[model samples]
Target: MQKQDTGKKLTVSLIVLALTVLAAIITRLTGLETTSAKLIGSFAAVFLLTGVVWRFPFRFYCMAFGFEVLAAVLGSALNLYHYLGFYDKFVHYTSGIVLAEGGLILIHALAGRRHTPAEPLLCRLFSMFFAIAGAGIWEIYEFTADNLLGINMQGDNTNTMGDIISGTLGALTWFGIHTLMHKRQQEKQ
Candidate 1:
């Protein structure tokens, strides 16, 4: 199983790398140097994350890489965010879900290390807060980028608030679903 997972990881990593190169080409053709650079940087970050979480399930890496492709490639490089006003919100919502998953993974890892089961309530709280904190940190990044780099990453106050709200709602949705799943799993045991 581990060997199979390793092969799968290699395949997925190659696909992502190829997509990143394609996105870079498209952005470069459109003269969007900044967007191209950002996309490549995003790919690098995702690759690093894969190395860091190599022991985790492939699905988690897929989730993170999928977000990078959606947000960096399709959204920015393809300029989908500008054409589709809701795309940004959708991305933010997905980010929340991803962050929530990250939180769950972390909790599970810690529990395994301690040779104990994760507490249900603690897991839920961690997931929710991890997503919420991630949202906050993202907003801060946008703000800082906009202010320091003279880039309009955050748009106006309304857009920023909407992003935060959307992310929070996503986290809530994930929490509800995860709770139900956990309950079902426990009942089965």
Candidate 2:
């Protein structure tokens, strides 16, 4: 049953990724240079990361992979960030949650499945740290692109700070929910 579920998830993730790539191609063919560049860059990065994550032995990686691809498609190809003022914040926040989940999976996998929900503090901390680090690295990427490629990824310090804060909050929210869920499950068990 678990293997079947994992296969379904992987299939869905791959489909989403394919759609994202198609969006990038369409944009490029349409001569939307800026949007096409953004889409292609985001798609490439996610594709590479997904390739690495594929080697991992956890189902959560599929969830994170799908979310990241969808976020990139919405932001770059669909222009959600420009059309909806809050879309960027939404993406950043969800990204934090996804990253945190990935971190927790990594910790569990590295620990050889010895860790349990009963002892989750370390995993939670690692998740939060991972999310924050991801946000910081993303900011650096934005800054670099804005300066070197003249892209308006960062816009300004204010936007950068806001994005970081939003991401952190998202991580916190996910941690809280995860803890509660685990606690409930433990009680039931």
Candidate 3:
């Protein structure tokens, strides 16, 4: 019975994931803006994965609700009107991608260290490396948009570096805080 239930859940999840992917493709192609497309995609992945995994309420909380909120908030940090610059009208999509990738690591740190929700400082630093690397790629994409695609992201090399710095700061801060909070809770218990 348990196996059958899991199978059914998996099937449903696949269907939902397909639908979500479809929506993302459509949005991206229709020129709905890249950042929006990314958030939509992230939401779909988290909700679908959580539903299919059949995790307990706590896991679901960490994976779906917590991660989604964190990703969105971190992503918004870079989209402020000031960063938008004049020509781009304050709309560039690469920031969201950088932030989303960082958020993913943060999610991993939370659930990845299930044995001790509080991973060591080294682990957090290690994850920060990946986050920073992903941010580098994101900057490249932004550069492509500005130079090749003629989108004028207003994010030249300096802007790209700034984005990377902010992304690293965001990821490291989130992870460090999470680890500290988790350890504190454990102590109380």
Question: Tens digit of lDDT per residue, candidate 3, span 52-156?
Answer: 445433333333333333333223222223333431221222333334444545656577768556445555555556666766776777777788878865456
Q: Pick the lDDT winner.
A: 1
Clashing pairs in 1: none
Off by over 4 Å in 3: 1-119, 185-189
lDDT of 2 by residue, 107-189 (tens): 77767666544348888888888888899899999999899998688977889999998889888988899889879988999
Sorting all predicted structures by lDDT, with the top scorer first, yields: 1, 2, 3
User: lDDT score of model 3?
Assistant: 0.51
The TM-scores, one per candidate, come to: 0.85, 0.78, 0.42
- Whose lDDT is higher: candidate 2's or candidate 3's? 2
Evaluated at residue 77, the lDDT of candidate 1 is 64
Candidate 2: lDDT of 189?
97
**Each model's number of backbone clashes?**
0, 0, 0
Backbone clash tally for model 3?
Answer: 0
